[model samples]
Target: MAKDRYAPKTLDDLMANMSSRMSSYVGKSQQLNQHQELLTQCVGATMAQKCRISNYRDSILVIEAESAAVAMRLNYMKMSILSDLRKNGLADLCQIKIQTSPRAAADQQAQKKRSEPIHNSRILSQQTADALLEVAEHAPASLKTKLEKLAALSKKNK
Candidate 1:
């Protein structure tokens, strides 16, 4: 029988062949890392801390922000960031896209803590109900309607 020359004969040979086959993927990963490093340098440490380069595709650099407010702020810096990327040899970078991701775990937990409803009580005293009604009388029409509803609900609870 003829020797199967293409078949790897050892684990090291197989690993070498596999790495060669994956070279393109490794190169692409390196390019992505370079782009991310460039972006971080361009945007500076503070702004970069709030966002990351999520992808670069079809000449667009997609950035992921921690929140919509941060995205908005990044949007304002899009042009400058693009220019900086080009200057740093990322001439293919033509546009900047800022996408908002959900808050990180710590930020979400802090928000939850801040928004937690008071557990003391939902019940309202007669005096508090009367106070709401009195405030409603002096409030603007729009606010008055809402306050009146609250006062009515408070009275019903009592």
Candidate 2:
């Protein structure tokens, strides 16, 4: 009888095999990093909570403010923000643009093209689908993140 060559007979052997397959991705270029940072900072600005960053390019960043007031303020403050980003080395590779309307309107339209059942995506991952169904059995409205809280509250009442 031949020995099972594929099986890891011990935990250390399994860990060693996994470690041999590992690789690193530590460094990124300054230009790409700067553009990403610019996008992030623009999204973190005061007006950004009511806004969304949805368009980016090698030299442009476009955002959509949720309100007219925010849009106006962002437009007025654009140059200052751009200067700040340049000073911080972000705008060196990225320019800023603020729009009052949604940049993701096209994305919303694409999503509208999706007319399949809501559960179509759920079925894509069988494990997640089963988990969601199992959770639904307990409380249809209870979210997974809220499960522990609900259980704790129930225990306290008992």
Best by lDDT: 1
Give the alpha carbon lDDT tens digit for every residue of 19-102 in model 1: 987997788788888888898898898888788777788998888888888899889988999999999989877788889886
Full-model lDDT, candidate 2: 0.59
- Per-residue lDDT, model 2, residue 91, is 41
Tell me which residue pairs clash in candidate 1: none
| Segments of candidate 2 deviating more than 4 angstroms | 1-45, 102-158
- What count of clashes does model 1 give? 0
Worst 10 residues of 2 by lDDT: 23-32
lDDT of 2 by residue, 57-77 (tens): 676767677567878877887
Supply candidate 2's per-residue lDDT for 148. 46
> In model 1, which range of ten residues has the least summed lDDT?
102-111
| C-alpha lDDT (0 to 100) for residue 12 of candidate 2 | 87
Once superposed on the true structure, which residue ranges of model 1 sit more than 4 Å away at CA?
1-21, 103-158
Report how far off residue 42 is in candidate 2 (Å): 6.7
Pairs with backbone N, CA or C atoms under 3 Å apart (clashes), candidate 2: none
